[model samples]
Target: MMKVFDEYRALSDDTLKPDQPKAKRFIEAMRKFLDKKENWTFWLPYILTLELCVKCGTCGEACPVYTASGRKEIYHPVYRSEMLRRIWKRYFTLSGKIFRGLAGAKDVTEDDINALAEAVWRCTVCRRCAMVCPLAIDNGLITREIRKIFDAIGIAPDELKENGTRAQIQYGNATKTPTEAFKDTLEFIKEDIEDMKGVSVEIPVDKKGVDYLVINNAGDYIAFMETVMGIVEIMNYVNADWTLNTPDTGVNDVVNYGLFYSDAELVAVAKAQLETIRKLKPKVVVIGECGHAYDSFILYKKLYKEMYGEEMPFKLTHIVALIDRWIREGKLKVDKNKNPEPVTFHDSCKWGRCAGVYEEPRRVLKAVCKDFREMYPNREMNYCCGGGSGFAIMFKDEFLKFRMETYGRIKAEQIKATGASVVATMCANCKGQFREIIKYFNLPVRYAGVSELVANALVYK
Candidate 1:
């Protein structure tokens, strides 16, 4: 048996830790995982990446964590992937069988499992390394594979599993918002929007045959009410038909934390969300202000076809893209004077790079802000807010420290260089991370969602 490093084991609330897997269990899990032919198509590139890496060190330079941590060897982009490669060589490769420990092949041990488990979480899995890779290898995909193994063996982060996806599955949201509470939250938001923005917007719930089925991260209702308000205001302004799934409908959040580690969890959550979507019967589904939610649905489309032998019924679109089109088509008039301050955007990895949603948010920002500054490397090549892959919510004390000081340091520097008073991001995770890092580093910047900025600038006549 192997105990995880102290930092990796601590829960976000500091109250409890889940059981760690033993060495024998880890070996069995890996053996079963590698042998499964169903997973080969998914994992083949990871195996190829292992064989293809040439130690060119270009990926290391592109890694924010490695560069921010002063190039720590352990935090290298390929550091953990290299460990998996060695393990594969020792246990499954012919060369390793013939020349064990002779050419960088090390036998798998409890320490390796322990060390590898610890190393995997340090990454945001932003795939910036893959973008810069000469051979198109993705260290991020390899990292997720390693994480999937530990997650299957019951050794994954508690925030991502028990308290996250499980809670979402049970209560219709990751925050454990019950049926009554979700209804009450909608009521409160509707009233708050009327009071604050003077807009009497009806938040439609479980309304059948709507043109759009709008979904958001459940956390937004609690922590980012403005984002939800913005969506409501915009939807109402355009007089578009949309409905939110009530808790009784068995869908509350768009978050699929399963995308971080486990495919089974991904499919399970998607299945649950899809159950609600099918009930509501909308023409299209809109994802609101969440990056992983947007990316996971794209993953789910493929999985849905494979599992059910048909295409996902509804067309998918992002809120930013919708807002941009609304502005271009003059459906919503906006006055930039309402937001007369310097602003910059922090692109969420999954939304911007993975989903190719770069230009829409920028167009919305330019439409709503007086002074919009560009972070040096904007769009697809942008750096992560360092909170990708669910690390923003993993609030363990040591992990928190590493996130603020190391992982998020480069982002803070970028924000500072932009000299923007507010950094507007579309994704909830990026907003949360920027909020923390701004406070942690004491930077003179406020975090705002693109929707919030748009709401502020909406020309109400």
Candidate 2:
């Protein structure tokens, strides 16, 4: 058996060779694209905007990988951005060519390719850096463009290549689980809900005329089945006319990991969900506890509009916000006594930071948990769990350890200080990562999704 270090080493070494035909083509394409002086119109805005960056290193301090890696030179935010900046300078600025050394312009050699590949791909694109940056430079967008440049040359990381291809070819979702399996997973959740809550929840799959269609990430179906059950329970309890589209139901393919650049591929994924909504002619679309799903839908709404020639017909809502609305409207009632433990909430990167969804989850938690305490840097400033952007599946051991040692360290300490026995988060990804980190640290705190807590606290009369 290959050791863990050996496995990662082998995977890292799989980067395309400089002399490879595909690599040559990619470099040529990138060179041509960059060389187009007219293209400077598009590039200048970002460069000019970035020039205002004060380099206060606030973003550097906010990065989970940088913190976990002990602020290594290669993991620094400026280091990766500088790599792209140097290349941009060489191609776009005349001074860079005449005084390349002074301008920090360096040729994109094989080592640079490998280093760029490794460095950019390591980020979860959690946007914690952008949240802290004074200029809001959006390093995540920079990383995405870098991935696009690398992908044009067929040099994406193995995990990205495998997952992206699977999403495109298999179930049309990144998890690659078949539609039948997805249906079965829903059936299993229905059964579990029946057993746990004595409620028969009907999760409509592709049911037409529903008011809303909920899109769930496959990870929630498989590992966090309770969350799926909780969603169904709540929808059923409130008599909300919602359906799950099992046929191409897995639509959370933000694949922001940088493997896909074609707008066509992204639209294809977005359209699958929209098609379901269109067929059902739902009044709105409610994206479930998954943050990236909302980001894919709301933040990148233009992709769908460009593809289909109009905006998504229905409104889009994050599940937490929907729950909060329902609670405030008296559509749902919860008994906080069931969740008497003191609790704290972890803000999900996609929900809290990227999408600016801060208070909804807290509202849901405050209603469900008797005692709720805030993490030190809560909301948009919360640390990433280090296992996002497909890192949970790709870099299992290292990412999990990183979560425990860094992101979860402060969270765990906060939970301990609060004397809370549970930690709740609205995002399925955060719930998944926290479960692992809490178990690894043997912390007495239990982790639950805000929906799960609400489901348990339902006061049905």
Candidate 3:
């Protein structure tokens, strides 16, 4: 049950020797990052995460990665975090310098860095581990910081970098959808929504001074057009003053894969998105169907307030929370019988754990799902979809196999146990993860978005 990542296996025999230029560069970057006090602000959570760990294995029991690995020692939540602690102590702490070997501080090396780098990317940053820890130590946050260090040395998962981070910085969206194509996609979605739902709705684009600038995961428009339609249908039904900004992450696609790779990248992508909102001067920014993007916005909004001396001119809210509000307000009459199948909700780590959005999606689900069954350990304590970070998109042979058989297996079993034919998820990644697991495990389950369920349950007057 050991989950072996071939990429890590390939990286283990590292060529970045102590005397090599690459090693020197990597070490320099590591030292600069470790030595800086300003970065302490960025890494305070990681510092708290590393310092607070008591080597208690309680979190390991809760970690899907650790559990799926047959409780492999390397995959334990403590493994990489403890490694970071030792490295930090060795390089940065006085006790480490005075006591050295007695303090368990060892000299940092290329091999040590390589090992930690390899191990960190294997995690999903689901933060479920943190919930179970007595000290509330977050191994997921530690892993993400380690990935940023690895990324500083130009070591990172390519799927997230070339396709995700780089694309977001360059095009304002990770999918690399051109500005014109984005506009066209919106127009197409409006038409498609009208045709499919018999709801002729105007999809606003770049219209300034709206109360809300609603943005969704651009991936939905590209891969799941119906999700876009569902979101628009809800907006039109509510007669909300909203506009879809399709041009960039600044105004449009509200996803930031940089959260998985680098803090700098996360900030850059957020600034672009924030600048777009500022230009539009919307009252509230509603993130649609993408949990992590909302997570990024929540984190970055605070950071922006710190850096810019004032919060942006907009309030931030997730569509799920907004939908729940609408349901409670009787703004949309829902017919739960429209979804006749037994359904269960899967909590996106970002929405439920990271963002504390526990009840909104379920409340929305309950509004539309007749036979909604609760998955064991649902909400804040829920298991990851095995693709929380970005694994669902890594389709390479060995990585894909590890993803499905190792990370995704437990989730697939969880759904199978639910006896629910439809599994509802808010995050696009969660949906993709479940879809993959259903295929791999041959389970009788299909994925549905909360918006999709809402759209289905809409009482068409």
lDDT scores in order: 0.84, 0.67, 0.78
lDDT of 1 at 90: 79
TM-score of each: 0.95, 0.87, 0.92
Model 3 scores a TM of: 0.92
Which stretches of model 2 miss by more than 4 angstroms? 1-12, 15-46, 49-56, 248-265, 396-411, 414-417
Tens-digit lDDT string for candidate 1 (268-387): 899999888888879999999999999999887887787678998889998889999999999989999999999998888998778888889889999999999999787878888878
Over the stretch 190-251, how does candidate 3's per-residue lDDT look in tens digits? 88877877888988888788987888887888776667778889999999999888664354
- Global CA lDDT computed for model 2: 0.67
Query: Any residue pairs clashing in model 3, and if so which?
Result: 172-249, 250-273
Regarding lDDT, does 2 or 3 come out ahead?
A: 3
Error of 1 at 23 (Å): 2.2
Lowest summed lDDT over 10 consecutive residues: which window, candidate 1?
9-18
List model 2 lDDT by residue over 281-308, tens digit each: 7677777777666766764476566567
Best candidate (score: TM-score) = 1
Q: Look at candidate 2 and tell me the lDDT of residue 13.
A: 37
